[model samples]
Target: MADIPAEGLPPADYAALCDFLRARTGLSFTEAKRYFVDRRIAARMAAVGVATLRDYLNVLRFQASGEELQRLVNLMTVNETYFFREKYQLDCLVRSVLDELARNRRPGSRLRIWSAGCATGEEPYSIAIMLLEQWSRVDEYEIEILASDIDSAVLERAREGIYDERALQGLPAHLRSKYFQPVRGALAADGARWRIIEELRESVDFSLVNIADPRQVQAFRGIDVIFCRNLLIYFDDLGRREAAGMFYDALAPNGFICLGHSESMSRMSSLFVPRRFPDAILYQKPAEGGAS
Candidate 1:
């Protein structure tokens, strides 16, 4: 988080930059947030040796390789998440959501779960590990787990599936042993690293996605459960509405949506009704209505 002096970025340049980012990623910054965006952009500009916001915008717009835009997106998006984060919701998914889906699923149909805005793969891998733990005869059921993030760098690291001990802190010891093996490095105990076992690693498919893109988000169809934690809090009103609609469209009838504990669809859309479980609360797309 570099701190750029507000006086450096001209108003016109800031507006153009905002419009560009909004069109591409559906994220918006307010007047108060202008400084945040400016600071981050200034950091990128410094990295590229471009002194002015206008010049950087030109590079982002006209660059042939499109690499600059990717770098900008990587910088702007937040990827803070850990293994077994918001454990109560995950417990609800395993205890209630999966059981309901399993009962209704037709023979040989794969149970599909999507981890939208899955940063560094921890969320989806956590889900996979949970499913394996909950379902003893896991091979008897078909499963499809898709994890996506806006940041390509984090996605690559997630694919590598290596993490320090801190990331595994929330995981139970027995489950950790079963699913992960030590990395080659023999560092200090707290700093020691481990890799997710090949079985769990292969079980998930990771991809680059901008959830704000309607066409791209609609590709997720027939999904039974979606873990979209901590994703929508960044969007403005319009972006939130669009994302809510897209989620509704992507879900199957009666599908469950588990958002971040702090996030709510209460004011955004009526398509998803709130459902309360003992451990957590979640939203579900209506079983009867056409997606709004």
Candidate 2:
């Protein structure tokens, strides 16, 4: 077996750390995620020159201002996302879902889209771009995009709307050229960098939100669709159930949900029914369910 790092949490410490994190963030760390949690915690501990996990836990629990806890959360939360991820899902949203909306929605009604865990704003911005692409009469229809993430750091970046070339990899060349312009300063690399256009950047509203916190998430309601991809996989059963219920309540009746390609609401909650499209599978809060 490989040797454990000196800063690595022992079994008991690991268990305690998991409990601490779960209580605050509602994210459960199973044995399968042990290495990931360990590495993140160990690195944070090392940065502060802490020798034991117990000491770090004390800092998290008793520290004034809760800065340490926020730091840990920022480090622990995964923010791996790119433009136009899971293209088929976006395609379905633009084609099938929007078709349903256009037919059913009343006149002068806006489409409200929430991108939960919208790290760095790619998902919500993608939604906006897709809406613009699919809807020709853009000026006639209002589009409201609310993008949120638990990590404040990522939200700041999302608001900036600047990305390196790597983050633009999945974005189509034509769309990228049309929507982004080169940044002309030392802060960004010469031709390899781009920033979202003012119109598209302003189309989204970014905020800090913890989906596990019922009080925080309760603010989201009457949403026409939610894009919460690769997020529930990190939560425990309780967390998943609670978040799913919140999502169910947040949606307008018949509103849709698009999760990560690998994620499913089955076995987790009965709130949403599976809806299949030619290219993707989605979940829907039934119109007949009477507010789930």
Candidate 3:
């Protein structure tokens, strides 16, 4: 939340340094945000042996060749997301999307969903479980869940397919008992250890991806539905526009693009048409919009 003038900021412009981070990593800031940024970036101050942000940036640019910039990006873009984080969106999907998919399902068809920026495995696993709950034989449709994030650390953790019991706070007792194992070892000492059932874990494929880079575009291929929630708020207007365009192109014809509750496509029209639903609003490419 701190937006102290970047000009000659204390001990050499840490405030201005944050502005640089806004462009580099797409973090918006204010006075309250300054504390989080200062606390996190200041940790690097010790690593670089530099007393200031200016020195840190200098090292990243000229001196340190390894673990400098990459670590900075990791530290900056890491966002905390959890399974069934937004009940409203899931409700809309269960009510509207599922109905549409059921009605639209051909004799035999699959549903493809991409949880872009899936932090750990929560979101995709949530989707898989929802589908399983809906259909006794959920495997009938070809379901593909692509979960991606820029951080390798989180990606590895997501692959582990583990969580804490706290994630099941709102889950029905039957589902919670059915899905999670009661780990009671030294680790279970915390009383919050959780392991996602094998059935849900197998439904998703995880990968290290940067949405900004064009090279990873193929990772989003043939996506029918996207849950790009809570991630894009980090980007500035221009970055948001570019990222939205990429998603629109990645989605198939009539494919649904779900954004965070805070996001919208009022201006973005490169490939998506905003469609209002009863609860959650998503963008879809019109039938006339190019290739599916």
Clashing pairs in 2: none
> lDDT tens string, model 2, 1-292?
2233655657887888898898888778887788788888877877767776777888899998888888888888889888988888998988788778767766577888899999888888888888888755455667789999989899999999988887899988999999999887785755567889999889898888888888988899999889999998889888898889989888988999888978888857888989898878889998886324
Q: Report how far off residue 257 is in candidate 1 (Å).
A: 0.8
TM agreement with the true structure for every prediction:
0.91, 0.91, 0.82
- Our tally of clashes for model 1 stands at 0
Better of 1 and 3 by TM-score: 1
List, residue by residue over 1-292, the lDDT tens digit for candidate 3. 2233443246346557756666555555555566666666667666667765666777776654546766776777765766678877877766677566656676357777888888777888888777777544455567778888877777877887767766666567777678766666776676767777776777798887778666686667667888888888777677787787788768777788888877777654456767778978878866675422
- Candidate 2 is scored at a TM of 0.91
Which ranking of candidates, highest lDDT first?
Answer: 2, 1, 3
The true-versus-predicted C-alpha distance at residue 93 of model 2, in Å, is: 0.9
- Candidate 1 has what TM-score? 0.91
lDDT of 1 by residue, 36-147 (tens): 7777888898888876676788899899997898898888887877789998888898888787778876667788899999888999999998887876545657889999
Residue 250 lDDT, candidate 1, scale 0-100: 88
Candidate 1 regions with alpha-carbon error over 4 angstroms:
1-8, 186-190, 290-292
Worst 10 residues of 2 by lDDT: 1-10
